[model samples]
Target: MRILRTALLVALVVGVSVSALAKADAPLIDAVRSGDVSVVRALLDQGADVEGAAADGSTALQWAVHEGRAALVELLLGAGADVTATNRYGVGPASLAAENGNASILERLLDAGVDPDTTMPGGETLLMTAARTGEPDTVRVLLARGADPNVREELRGQTALMWAAANDNAAAIHVLAEQGAHLHARTDNPSRSPGRTFSSTPATGFTPLLFAVRGGHLDAARVLLDAGADVNDAVSDGQSGLVVAAANANWEMAAYLLDRGADPTHAGAGWNALHQTVRTRRMNVGFGTPGPFAAGTLDSIDLVRQLLARGVDVNARMTRNGIRDGQRNRFNRLGATAFMLAAKVTDVETMRVLLEAGADPLIPTADGTTPLMVAAGLAIWNPGEDGGTLSGQEDEVLEAVRICLELGNDVNAANYRGETALHGAGFRGANIVVDYLVEHGADLTALTEDG
Candidate 1:
């Protein structure tokens, strides 16, 4: 009975002591978080736990470094705080310092024996983090302290220079380049898994220049180009810088790339920048009311003119087994020209531009689908599923049909499937186009090959 009483008394005393210790440690963390140097010193003097962590596993020293409290950081280190302590996110004091652009604090941490090349949980190095901050001093400090400028992250194989370029950090890009970062380092190429075909997988081979162009960072792109980055470098999918710019309707970037010797005729299989530009514009700017034209529309027109002036073929056709094969509706077909693509979307303005640039409206696809057939909504294989209807685009389709007819397309012409523009209009339930076709002498007796 006596021993049981003594054990109970001792347990009670130990619980009280542990609770007191926790109470003492809580104030130290709060003091560090609030940047109270005197309070932190007093807590340490009172034997507060220097390594006490908040709920997120952030110790006093880590908080000090993150908050840029150099004096508190020094005091904590003197109190035997762990410099290598990390938060639950795997972010250590050094990484926080780098990400915050506190070069002096980073140097102090490095001097205190933190590994300069320490990576995050995902293998992102301090230099990569600093580069993304757009601070040249932090990047310089990391590089000077032996952080590799060319070191790639484990997941994407992206270097510090790539990160800098992606974030529009031109100064960091310049520094990384001077430190021997690879000018054309690409991300890891996407691998085709066992059941996945190459076309089903997305392209992942993006260089620093491509990253800059993808973000529309003209200054970063210029820095990379002047540093000898390849202007014509493409991803695994063959999308070059010019094609990317065209796809995004970035006329300025496209013009810049063209001036820097980007091949206007460079094609990914059968699709060129012109095709991308027209297709992208059609998707972004749907057929609205006839316009005085938006600023973006005018810019796209200028880009088209520039592409034509640079010698892009106005009548270029998609190849038999091209990059966009089996992708969707009319665009999936072979021998389809840019004019036909514009026609399919009922983009009368683009069709006019193509005609002015000498595009042949009579050119047909491999299936003998003419620009007129496409304009009348006859080219879609599955009219119900694909965007084949001229429901709201009756005016545009009528104008396009008129343009095709005026350009000498025979209204009675039939595709290889024996389907005429009338059949196309009927398939899409476009009574407006059907009536117009009938008025234009479409052969009502025409029958498809199946009939």
Candidate 2:
């Protein structure tokens, strides 16, 4: 049986002529590497596998296509190279050609039966990949070649349009939209599985609207909004696009959403935008970013003022995380009045804004921490020359102390630690603030366990 099998192999080799078959075997590799049309033609004439691959899993046609050798690519295709043949990682010849900017080669491969919708390991389709490069022409070619505009990868839930939108690829987005891509399709599954967290979701779990608002594509957000995409669709942790827009300081987008009835007061937002801005600024802590919050131009303090003007609770306490037994939609234990938040940041404008809007400075916190206590503590804890206004630092601290007095705060008010604002100033060596506190009837004799 071994002898018979050997004889059959010998006969097959002889039938094709050993030299001719040997030449056919490696000819495609040589032709692509050399970009030579005649060698490619000879190999095809001798019945070589026109799609023969190198050790790395790239085919002869892939090499020719990637090199932009139009003639060799044509010859290989005519020899029946499988255009859709994927590399080890599933990147097809058309994708390889697209990667190298060989559009002509891409066209030839597509014409030779490459599937434009072929996906990579993570379910990233060719169109999604192309959109990531921000190449409008490649995107247009793929769309025109019948790639489904709304096709989504199962793992990531990313559509081609989503990729374009997330990358801020305006032209590609325009082309994909014109080609009928579904803008509303979620690019990532927010509720899929524990394995598919917001961090793990494909393309950031961002919808077209979230991408638009976060990426500063106000125009795109407007377009999507007009097309009937829900303005209030919350994805991760119940954070809506409006929330992202507000968090990012993209005022135009926020205003746009607000105008379209997007509630500035979103679920899971510990406080409204205005209150958050005030608290973050006063504490010298940003909402998420670093530095004193500038309350950038896009912030709708005006809108907040308007809400307050209409009698929305200016002194409302936000349900923050540090609070205890907080009922849903009700003030939590750590909830700070608008005035408390304002005093912490020492933004005179914010203070003025809240006060004008009817926030009562007299309200004391659960721990007996008043707005004055918060301001004095912030002034002491916040370090450096830029901590606050140097010239009026003492006066500002003193003024808060005086305001508390006027508002009927206890003359010797103490906090959970039994520390008054005076203790904070004296321990920190803030002579000016301490002097002001003492002169304004702060209890010099008050002593906590630390004192």
TM-score against native, each model: 0.84, 0.67
Off by over 4 Å in 1: 1-24, 191-202, 284-298, 320-330, 379-392, 445-451
Cα lDDT, model 2, residue 50: 67
Report clash pairs, candidate 1: 378-424
Q: Residues 186-222, candidate 1, lDDT per residue (tens digit)?
A: 8883642111121222447778998787666789999
Q: Name the candidate that leads on TM-score.
A: 1
Whole-model alpha-carbon lDDT for candidate 1: 0.74
lDDT of 2: 0.60
Q: Please give the lDDT score at residue 240 for candidate 2.
A: 63
The CA lDDT of each predicted structure is 0.74, 0.60
Candidate 2 segments whose C-alpha is farther than 4 A from its true place: 1-92, 96-107, 134-156, 170-206, 277-313, 322-333, 363-368, 378-411, 417-419, 423-429, 444-451
